[model samples]
Target chain A: MEPDTQNGGGMAKLGIWLVVLLLIIGGIVVYGKRGEDTKKASVKEPIKIGFIGPLTGDLANIGANTKAAVEIGVDDINSAGGIGGRTLEVVYEDSQCTPAKSTSAANKLISVDKVAAILGDTCSSATLAIAPIVEQAKVPLISYASTAAKVSDAGDFIFRTVPSDVLQSSFAAKYAVEKLAKKKVAIIFVNNDWGLGLSKGFSEAFKAGGGEAVFSEGIDATSKDARSLLSKIKAIKADILYLLVMPGQAEIVIKQAQELSLKISIFGADPLEDMTVWNNAGKAGEGVMFTTIGTSPSDDFKAKMKAKVGSDEIIYSGPFAYDGLKILGKVIGEVGTDGTAIKDALYKVSYEGGVSSPKIEFDQNGDPKEAGYAIKIVKNGKPVVVK
Target chain B: MDIVPQLIANSIIAGSIYTILALGFNLSFSTGKFIDMGYGVMMVIGGYAVFYLSKILGLPLPVGILLGLVISGLVSYLAYTVVYKPLRARKASGAVLLIASLGVLTALQAVIAILFTSQFQTLSGLLSGNRVFEIFGGAITAVQLTTLALGIFLFVILAVILKYTMCGKAVTAISDDEEVSKIVGINTEKIIGSVFFISGVIGGLGGMLIGFDTGIEPIMGLPWLLSAVTAVIIGGIGNVYGSIAGGFLLAFAENFGIWQIPGEWKSAITFGILILFLLFRPRGLFPK
Candidate 1:
């Protein structure tokens, strides 16, 4: 009986020890699962990109249209299983078309959001403001619109989907000197980075191409009265008036010129190609001509944009913005979220199926290799390509 | 083509617009004893109201203009009752009132932006076709001539009223000392409200004219307000006729200043003149 009692005690002790071993194994399995969960969470996190543009201010139309195009690009990418099975997210900030606001917005996007890349800053002023910030942070900045010539020298990380104003301005110069045979031209431009760059580029190219710039004036973008400037241009009696202004301001200048019976021919940059110019200026914009970047948009892209934006009146920058985001996604997918790696991939990438152009490849200066400009003329309150 | 005649015409046109804006600003500032920053947004309201009435709703031009004027006056009266009057009842300081006015300005501008999308719009289509008249080798539009005529007429009428009429005397009395005027049986609030209405009408007219002559945008008000404020400061803040002289003087300075310099320096020249006037002749030409 004593031996039997001792055996029972030994069996109970073994049972307790076996229960302890089972609990220990279960705890290890649960901990290992937690560790696996954390790894998966890190891998499944959404890839975030930042967008900055004039979402609420003067250039809101352009910014909003570009945003719509970017949305389409994002939707397409995500629908195709996103970039390497992770969802893509875009955080937008309003630049207000101003430098001060854009700098702060860019800083917020870079420091707070810790985004991998940035798209937009539609205005040249805003792009130039954020260029140094993104460059310093080693984040790739792809401007969809900003066409200032100085943007070419912004930074290594700075790139634009749209061609520089250099090409458009040179094209304008050639069109004025060779096509229209205008020797003495009066240049009136908005007093902003883009306008100033166009003015400089057009003047240099025109002079180099054996045409004379008789008078040049930079009108304040906020100034409504161009009568004084128009008078000065009239005094010079140039054959053509080259306007480097936006659609709204361009409409005003054209109407005012008509009211003053100033009969000089008017030429402008890309912004004048919008329906706004024709609608506002009416018959005054009848014979106006301008140079615009890129070929005509593809029918598929146009239809998609019309569906997305709820209007057929997409701005000139819309297609380029779409292409910009797609290129960004492709680069990110190819090389991952590292800014340096993405930028390097971008430099080496040659995207062919973008809406902006048939083939888009960046040169050393971060400009597109095949950026070409087309001339458009207004007829019956509509922009028609000049054949 | 000598630029002198054109420069003179340009200065006169700009001066006319400034005169109208200054007169409106001066009326409110004098009677209210505070800078009504919201007064700037009233111009936008006026322009947009006309746009909605004529362009959007397909009303006749005259009807749209009349309704726009009435709407502008009513909106200003509402602002006084809704915003300034309550603050005044609380005995708010001028600084607080100024801040409140700024808030009103920002809110109103944002609302306009939301409704109309900050794009520049024109009212030239309402005029059928703008006609040009050549004068002394300078070109003038029918709109500019009308603006000048309206400015001159309003200036004369306002001057006459201020100098001779009972209502004008009451306004002046209230402006000089509101508490004293109230003690002396002047309905101070009523007078201030009327002054606001009158200023709003004048500002609306200025906006409509400018819209016809050039174009109008949500941000159009601030530039006009800036010019008007400069005129008021240079012309003596409380004086109506002084604002006219100051307006013309500034227009001339701005136009002539840029004649020798690049056009980009126009704003610099304008601010430079303002600074010079503030430094040397604080009371301005024809001081109150």
Candidate 2:
């Protein structure tokens, strides 16, 4: 048999079928045209705001929380008739907490989502990566937590709602020197931009405060054993411990230090404020002190959050998220959908109160310029204001 | 002096972990003649499995461990069967297999993230209870001591089997020459399968120990994998005893390296040694 003959009798029937297919496609096109005209009359066009953060990875919690915060802001605005009378919508892009990915996410949010603004990013590295993306797109991006000093100064288009590392680092070191009343301190930080940035600032502030940093060491961010780290800190006979690991490694160092009976005052940066400390270290974490960007959780914030979320999962994380959204909304209303205008609005704006903290404002770099770190100590299973 | 014992003890402990992972990594690479990057993902999957069973589902720790082991072992076996087996049949290059392993790594990490979320989770409450023990000069938790014992136990069991058992001899023969082992009337497929299962077991155990010590997270696989690989490469690839010695050496060196310098330089020291070795003695301390 010929090779073409093997195609079967069905192949010859295709000429008539092609004509029928075109007719069917033409009918559908007519229906779509009619439907498009009708829908334009009824609903208010939604203003799409893009959100970029790590929804997956080691830093998913902060990423997820920051993303949610942006959404909450949009939700509040849309519920109240939105900006320029258009409903607000958020398009989320996952950054994986890397600058490269964050930049890609920024581009997609701008080109694909066609969003007027963006909210993101818990990591400073990601902030650095996307700074150019947002600037080129001229889309105002208000970050919930990226606090690296370079992030805010990236361009006029970027702004940060969270407090800067500068304040937190200084506050953390100061807590060790003054509050813990320790004259000699040893620092153990993770090796990274976040760790390095904080280390430089903390050392300067700590030395100025008249405390000697006998040792300032960094371990791999993912180090399996920090006992060697603890040993180095212990050898210095440091009266205070300055640690800057993420929640997981922090617990290891804390628990190991406790086991060794190396009872020194523990001072930490903001990431240490995660619940993992109490969850993993338990009683061993008692008396630890740390400084953070957010306003302390007040009773009023708790009550309001409970009323808003009613979900046990988001209770702790929701307010900061909600605050992030509201800030974005307020900026949008004042800035008139312009990225630069919104960035400018973040500079002078003040939040009356929000879930994670009270009264939010940013300096020129989009960082909470005047934002001071609030020092808190663990006592009786709760973080009490120490200063 | 205060830091010396601490650093030594810490390095030994850290080395034990690296050895656990490195031993398994080499086991697969040696026999298969290709380094499977998926070895690290197995650890994350195992940890996430235990976390789900024990913490989320509220099962007993031992049961969770068993569940984790079974799930992880089965997954690795399937990975070999489905992905590696097909690729090998196609006469795929090692680079191709490496790419497949990266894909598996991504998909597995995504699954873990979906199931457990991206947050670092620790097994606490009944999963982790109070048990602290002290030694002269420095101290470690009962959990840490238990991990050390398990590491030693697994090493002995593996060494004994590899040396004495017929299947073990087949594995060695395969590592030496796959074609020769198959021509000698040994079922290479069966032998490779068994090796994969053993490697998976070691990986699962490594994951469990890490859960007991440092917390577990989906993103932890690579860096942990890197450390183990560092030990394996430094000690001499496929040399079990060398891997063991390499692990301890690295741990000890890392601990001792940070003595006069700040603690943060600890990673830099480990990475620097890895680089120096790669440059100067790439064949490692005990090259095969």
Candidate 3:
């Protein structure tokens, strides 16, 4: 028994020394791994960008298309050997096309993802919601589709590839009064930030151009029934009807108006240039005229998008989104990943080969300076650029 | 334009839609003794079934409509047998049943959205062309006229059934006292199930008509459901004839009220009438 006890005590001491030696080795390995991780993080870290848009809900189709375009842009940049050997990474969050959801997404992108910049919030309301957050974080926010005039004053860091509604509405007003020679106008606008801005801007411009807005009314965006409103518009009997609504609502409005046998000329904004509207509205959408921003996509780029998205009818915003990413990448490459530095660099960008606009430059409000609108008319159930 | 004739025409068209929805809601609510939120999704099912048949499968309009009605009825009956019947056997409270109905509504809406993408689809091809008529200087469409006629026909048929038929008498008895009627050999479950099927058919018809008139979407059910519930509350819950009267009254109030106000105030006017009726005449215009 004594010999057994002595042997057991010796084994215990040996086991303790073995544990100590193993712990020492484990500590060295862990310390070395942590050091390597820090070195990689400092030198080879990816340039993370945040993308917030409606990935689900009512506007999911538009969101998906925009995301696809942005991905193509990322692929183009990375294939050109990424910005200084650091790969571009985009973290996407669904804004649900709502201000509340956009705010939450912006918080996550800024505080959690630690992104260098944000690209998105396609809707005007959502972009407006995230503006203050990004401005506070000193991060640059580049929107590809938001067109509200209020976005100009949203923040110093807020920028958009799409021209403001102020420009489009004013141009539309001039064309209606001068070109179409319509003196009396009836306006029906969707009751939202984008629609309200267009309505106010168009009405003011029309009145300034010596045209009278005989009737003006705001309809809820989700409203499906417009017979009563159309009846009222019919009674007023204006020369031109300005419908500032989305493509879905626009289709219903046009069809219902045709059913009512109202012979007034109809006009719309850029959103009406969708195949969905043309297909759904049937023959009623024929001869309807609208305004859209001009694009200069290269033949190769167009072919690439057609192959990537499996459709040739790319949305107008898709090209703008592609340009937005390229612009952001150029600036990021020139000025590094500092948000303030990128914001400063965005003002000086003179890009020549953007997919949407031929020459991309920013004004004081971070708006494109050399942008103009073009007229499109539906002919033979398809949108034809009016020269 | 003089707003009076347009307002009257608008009221009639809106009233016709509410009447059909309210009738079905009243029939189901009387026997079930629960709000039956699933009733709303059933309307969506009816609309989508008709869309799938007429638009996708290239079936005739009439055949698509008949199949839509049958599909909705069978789905409603299944909902009761599979979900509500077992819960009733366990003696669940009305609140629990109502919550369960909401669950059914959400799940069914998601399923429909998955199948038919959440985009607005129109039934423009079915009608060929919209025929318009002038009534007292107000414009009305052929579809609107059909909706009015269908509402009247359903009302007359339902009134006759409830007042003069044995099935109607059995349904009323079961609704009044399910356990007592069961004791008296009324087969309360069968009567209630039949009521559900009949109500589902009417609701499905209403859905198809609305889809034909305007357009249909996966989330189209909730608005129609709200209108139906408002009519039921104003007419007096559980009263068949009261719902008819309530439907027209709410329509007139909303249409006429929005004439002077902005058009955006139209939905608000509907709830305003509901609130006034709830406060002043809590039992509704015609209580059982």
Query: Using TM-score as the measure, which candidate wins?
Result: 1
lDDT computed for candidate 1: 0.87
Q: Candidate 1 lDDT, tens digit per residue, A216-331?
A: 98888888778888888888888999998886788888987887778899999887756767898899889899888855678887888899878787787888888888998999
lDDT top scorer: 1
Per-residue lDDT of candidate 2, residues B237-288 (tens digit): 8788867887888888877876666666766777888998899989789987
Ten residues in sequence with the least summed lDDT for candidate 1 chain B: B279-288
Ranking by TM-score: 1, 3, 2
Which is superior by TM-score, 2 or 3? Answer: 3
**lDDT tens digits by residue: candidate 1, B1-288:** 799998999899999989989999999999999999888888888888888899989999989988888888887888888999999999999999999988888888888888988877888888877888999988888899999999899999998998799999999998889999999999999989999998988888888988888878888877788889888888888898888888898898888777777788888877887888899988777666
lDDT of 2 at B121: 76
Best by DockQ: 2
Ranking by DockQ: 2, 1, 3
Candidate 3 regions exceeding 4 Å error are A1-46, A56-58, A107-114
The 10-residue segment of model 3 chain B with minimum total lDDT is B255-264
Q: Which whole-number lDDT from 0 to 100 does residue A35 have in model 2?
A: 74
lDDT scores in order = 0.87, 0.76, 0.86
The native-contact fractions of the candidates, in order shown, are 0.73, 0.88, 0.45
Residue A360 C-alpha lDDT in model 1:
88
Question: What's the i-RMS of each model?
Answer: 1.4, 2.2, 2.1
- Please give me the DockQ of candidate 3 compared with the native complex: 0.36
Mind sharing the TM-score for model 3? 0.89
* Structural RMSD, model 1: 11.8
